[model samples]
Target chain A: MITQRAANIAFNILVIVAAVFFALEAETFQTSGLLASTGLPSKFFPQLMLAFIGLCSVIVIGAYVFRGFAGTDKGASVFEDGGAARRGLLVLAVAVACYLVWSLWSFIPMLILIGPACALAMGVRSPWMYVSLLVMSGIVYLVFTQLLNVQLT
Target chain B: MFAGFDVVAQSIGQLAEPITLALLVGGIVLGLIIGVLPGLGPPIAIALALPFTFHLEPIAAIILLLGIYSAAIYGGSISAIAVGIPGTGAAIATVQDGNKMFKAGKGGEALGLSLTGSIIGGLFSVICLAFIAPILATVAIKFGPREFLAISVFGLVVVVRVAGESLSKGLLVGALGIFLTTWGLDELNGTERYTFGSYHLYEGIPLVPFLVGVFAVSEVLIGAERALQKLDFDQTSLTVKLPGWGKLMKMKDVLFRSSALGTVIGIIPGEGAAVAAFFAYSEAKRRSKTPEKFGTGHDEGIVAPETANNATVGGALVPTLTLGVPGSPAAAVLLGAFLIHGLAPGPKLFAERPDMMYAIFIGLFIINILMMVIGLMAIRFAAKLIQVPTTFIVPTVLLLSFVGIFSVSHSFFNVGVLLGAGILGYVVRKLGYSIAPLSIGFVLGPILENSLRQSLVIADGSVGEFFNTPIGLGIYAALALTIFGGPLAGWVKNKMFQRAEDA
Candidate 1:
């Protein structure tokens, strides 16, 4: 089980890295000579934001490192249990897969597959649940396609 | 300011049109249905419906969103009373006394009291909005870059401070949100910062889809986490019985104070219905003779939070409509709707579209009155929505968000952005960070950037010139007071008590 403090510290480290990378990238922004004479360069705001985010992230990492907790919950586990983690991570996987299916193939397949896939990921045992979800998918399809006249290819 | 009386008459006539009236009713019903579900609040409700408003006239579109905003705050109390699980954060304060009263067989009475209080508070705030918005707009119209920079800074700081237990975490995410907006072309200079060679990146981000993704898609992911969770509600205790004249008269002080407090709090940038509700609840408890009875099925406990949460609807619109600064997270999403309609909500909005202003003032009043009738009628059925299985809701909502985003622009990139924002929001939320500051930071990002740059240009590198304007200085003073006053007062009080004890 991952404690929230460890997870938060890790996330803050990633934020710091991202901020530094973006700040560096910002310095390479293409600018016209005339535009350079404006009040501030394009890199100015993004770099300022990056610096602020970096400062905040460092503060967070420091608090977590010293006190083992910084906010909200103190040293709680990231997920409730192994089962919950499995269920949550599985659902996230299913959501990502559905997105990929839609982008790669077609919306129809993704829409049809998403409902049952998510329910199965959550370990649903009831057949009626799947049936109900299908009906809901149908309703949504009709509402968008027929009523709203949206073309979902 | 009152020159819009004729325009007000015209707006009333326009609001009576069949389609606008139907959408108004539909928005409330939809609001109640969505609001009754645990974990889906006003921001999600408004975000989900924002895309469809693309085809609507400005008046009808805004009114639909307003109807949802007002009723969604009220609908949360129904679930709070019935299930002890607040449907929205705004109703968390009500769950203590409201659910207790329901358990004691006073559910109908509790429902009635909340409904009546919500209506009264909502009406009170609408009156305040009508009277105050124009006057503020009149002053705001004269504001330059320095003043806007002050307001934007104050908004971001206050939101971060109030949003979470750890200010650093909030600030980090808030900064991240603003940084994301610094993508595409710089409005001042044509330099591309983070576009990464994509034409879709030209707009930085499509606001409606991004907001929808933030609020709706993220909620779907969270709903998936507890997909197996089931709700237990007693249907026998679902009927509403409104408080009589005597009960209302007896609690008039609490009602009035909560309304006033909620409105004032709502006018402040980034403070939402939840803050107002909690503030009113605590204030009510402190002022009561039997403060100990507050959490134990007290009437004032139920009324104070319920009233204030609803009251925040009108108060939130004052800043959102007049200054282009959203007062709440829900209003932050609403700013997306306004922009979608190509109507920028600022002081110039008054001169550009007095008809729209009239529509909102009049429309909000009607939403409050109709919310009473619609809420009372729908509460019985709407309360059952809490029982809907998250197993199906998760996927269904995901589909809705996907389809909705795709329909908005016929682009797959937006759907990708939706997914990205959803994942970001889920991770951020699971880490115990509030999304309020992040969303507000995103909404206020361009303004913050533009105003700061313009102010710097005007100031010619002098820091003191940023506070030259009386309004700018006043706002900064208020920000200072908000930041330091509570802790300072507490410190002084402690010292005085220590001196007394030593003596």
Candidate 2:
């Protein structure tokens, strides 16, 4: 029963916290000689942007809290059902996994992961889909490496 | 400008070659196939073709891509007319009347009107582009960093306002996009903002991979959610009958007005063919003597949106060619193509390479003309394209995105950036936030940052100086009007109704 409003409020708060942390971290950017003499240091823009983002986040959270005052009720569930939630999370996990594979192994591993992972996330239970995906991955590999001569690590 | 005519003539002469003609035909056919299928449009079509363009000369490449761009917009209407489903977002408005006409057994008439409207609109806009672009390019040559900054801000804000129902959500996504671009090394200074000690981030995120990721990959993920559904439609009645000369002549006012409207809207940053189509549709309905017949399978319904949408192609190129500011997302991809060709699209481009400008102008005209012949042949088989399953499309799109992104930079890091961006785009889209503002913001980010920093230096710490330039102030004023005028007018109307109720 958690509505979009509640989710948005939580999201905004998290963003605000992140912005504050970044703003604080930006202080280590070092203000020296000419940079310090420029009236604002290198860190100025980042800090300013963070502050603005934080302010917007606060406003968004306030609006969510005072929803009725804005003449609209909090509407729609954040997730339709458990199935949707699971599928959405699975897709996110697959994306993250692909990123990790690319980072740790190589581009070939990540390329191999993309199709099967996507097909699985979409609930394609057929064995043929996997075969088709493998064929697709191979074609992509040939096209990039052979034809275009891309250095795919 | 008169001396430039010789270059135009030479470009025109080259376009007459058979190989160039073949590429145009091939590109249009390919574009139509991609566009008629659900979830693919001009940007995807162009992105897919980008790698292939690397092998061709500038004229051939531009001609082929331009063919794809024009035909794709036209192709979208095929599915909208044949089935209730829209092939592209631009064709969504076309469905209301186009599908209804098909249901009422006037499928041929509906399609004919759409085709004719699209061709007329395309032709009109190309002529407009030919006449207006060079003049605008001449003037744009005077633009400085301050002017460029104003233009970028105007584009980004307009995109955000038009992108979604929630202004705050749009702004947040837009800011997030710009913030992501701020990663890697700063250009003016050697300071690394958010590279996190990686040499891969030194050149910033590669444009091709990021766009392909955000648009193509994100779409594939979202397609997964609706993959289980089967689409059914009556395809037996699908036919196209080009409208007679008399009918088209009778509807000249609607055609001209819609073309102008589409072109003007296209000139504005971020507003694309789809928005122009819908706006033209509504305007046509508003001006019609029988407004009741509008959503009930009227020929005017097909004409208005079709004409406006196709006309926007030429309109979109104006800003992209002149100022390096892409007028639409597809144009953003096209800008990347320009960069890949080692051609920077800006004021200096006109001075440095007049032949390229002439080639684009002549090539675009040829594309529009060729679109008619190719579109007719292609539309016959276009409806069959929709039968392509989501399963096939998803993997193919993913593969294309993978190859396309890699082809641009030949770097795994770029591919990683693409995947990361794709996930972000998919998540945000599922949460009902639009990717338009985000994409536009990313494209405009460096321009905005560089311009702002330079302006600050020029202004010497005075906020008022930002508003001092006459052209800059005028642009800001127009932007303010566009943003606030709608709400202000609505408020006035509401107040008037209240007073009337009291009376």
For all candidates, the clash counts are 0, 0
Interface RMSD values for all candidates: 1.1, 3.2
Give me the candidate number with maximum DockQ: 1
Best by TM-score: 1
Task: Kindly list the per-residue Cα lDDT of model 1 for residues B1-503, writing each as its tens digit.
Answer: 87556898999998999999999999999888888888889999998888788778989999999988888888889899999988899999999999999999999989998888889899999999999999999999999999999999898889998899998888888887788888888898888778888989988977777777778877887777688888987889888998888988989999999999999999999999999999999999999999999988999999999999999998999999999999999999999999878899999999899999989989989998899899888888998888989887788878888888888789999989988888888889888888998899999999999998999889988777756789899999999999999999999999999999999
CA RMSD per model (angstroms): 1.1, 2.9
Docking class of 1: high
True contacts kept of each: 0.80, 0.13
Residue pairs with backbone overlap in model 1: none
Residue A76 error for model 2, in Å?
Answer: 2.2
DockQ metric for all predictions: 0.80, 0.31
DockQ of 1: 0.80
lDDT of 2 by residue, A1-153 (tens): 557677777778888888887777776664444545553355666676667667767766777787621113347665666665665567667766876787688888888888888778878888998888889888888877797677676
Where is model 2 chain A poorest over a 10-residue stretch in terms of lDDT? A67-76
Candidate 2 C-alpha lDDT tens digits along B1-503: 53356777787777777878888888888888878888788888897888778778877887788888888888899889888787777898899899999999888888889888988898888888778877888888887778888899899888888888777777877777776676666666656666667899877877777777888778877766666566766777766788899999988989999999999988898888889999999999999999999989988888999999999999989999888898988888888888878888886787887777777777777777777776666676778778766866776787677667666666767878888888878867766678988888788888887778788888887788866788888889999999999999999999999999999
